[model samples]
Each structure stands twice: as C-alpha cells, then as structure tokens.
Target: VARLQERARLFLELATQRGLDTGLSRGSAVIPVIIGDSALSLRLADRLFEQGINVHAISYPAVEEHKARLRFFITTLHSPDQIRFTVDALATTLSELRQEALYITPTN
Candidate 1:
C-alpha cells in the first residue's frame, strides 16, 4: 500500500505537470482523472481494457449529474513500470481523443 501510494503520487504529479485535469485525491490510491466528455472516457477505458489494462469511467448519474471521469485503481501488485505505462497510455489516449474531437466537431 505504501508503494502504491508513492507510485500514485508520482503519477499524479507527472499528470498534473503535463496539464491533465485529474480529480483524484493525492491521499487515496485510487486515482480519478477527469475526462470531461463521457463518451471519450468510455472509449479510453475500452481501449485500455483491450490492452489488458482494467480501468473504469464515471459519467452522469454515476457521479454528479453531467460529470465524466476515468478512474484508475492503483493496487499493491502494480509495479512502477506498470504505473508509468498506465499514465503514459492515458496521456496518449487523451491526446488522440482530443484531436479526433476537434476534427469531428463542426465549425461555426
């Protein structure tokens, strides 16, 4: 649990420094990164799952109404490399999704 907390703190620091809108509390091992867009959150979660990484997303009624987020569970079994992988994957996935959204959204 101590190791998990350390890894989580490092991950959260890296993520926040990179400007990701993460909402997870530093005190908890479970990390919640705000996706803002529910669909994108689900899509990212699916992508991670397909890669053999079990992740979850919160949307709408599951959280506060109309809010969406991706939740990451940091367990004692997770190594530093694994945590780094998850964080990197999340950053990459989010960047790709944002780009796709920008392209798909109709311009005024």
Candidate 2:
C-alpha cells in the first residue's frame, strides 16, 4: 500500500504541475481528475485502456452535477513505467484533442 501511495503521489504531482484539475489529495488509491466533458473523458479513458491502463469515466447522472471526470485507480501491481505512461498518454491525448479543436464550445 505504501508503494502504491508513493507512485500515486508522483503521478498526482506530475499531473498537478501540468495544470490538470485534480481533486484534493486524500491519499486514497483512486485519483480523480475532472475532465468537464463526458465525451472527452471517455475518450481519454479509452486511450489509457488501449495502453493497458484500466480506468473509468464518470458522467453526470452517474455522479452529482458538474462532476464529470476520469477516475484512475492505483494498484500495487502497477509499475512506475505504467504510471508514467498513463500520465504521458493523458497529456498527449489532451494536446491532440486541443489541437484538433475537438472540445465543445458555447454555441453563442
């Protein structure tokens, strides 16, 4: 458990430094990042899954309003490389999405 927590700390720190909106640290095994868009959240989750990381995307109605997010669980079986890969993949996916203008915008 300690090793997993340590790895989670590294991931959370890197994610926070990249300006990702991660929720307050509770030292729990699950790390939650608010993605705002359900579609983007799911896509990011799928990207991570493709890289062999298991995560889940939570959308409105599944949780309270405005809480859409991708939830990543830290397990003892995960290696440092896997954690780094997941974070890197997340950064790459978001960057690609942004460059592609795939995010929704206000219709006004």
Which candidate has the highest TM-score of all?
Answer: 1
lDDT of 2 by residue, 8-45 (tens): 88889878877777878568778888887777777778
lDDT of 2 at 103: 57
User: 90 in model 1: Cα distance from truth in Å?
Assistant: 0.4
Which ten residues in a row are the worst by lDDT in model 2?
97-106
Question: Candidate 1 on 1-108: residue-level lDDT in tens?
Answer: 678778888778877876777764777877888888788889889988877789898987787634588887777778888877777888887888788888795669
Q: Which stretch of 10 consecutive residues in model 1 shows the poorest summed lDDT?
A: 59-68
* Residue 63 lDDT (model 2): 67
What is residue 81's positional error in candidate 1, in angstroms? Answer: 0.6
Best by lDDT: 1
TM-score of each: 0.85, 0.82
C-alpha lDDT of residue 23 in model 1? 68
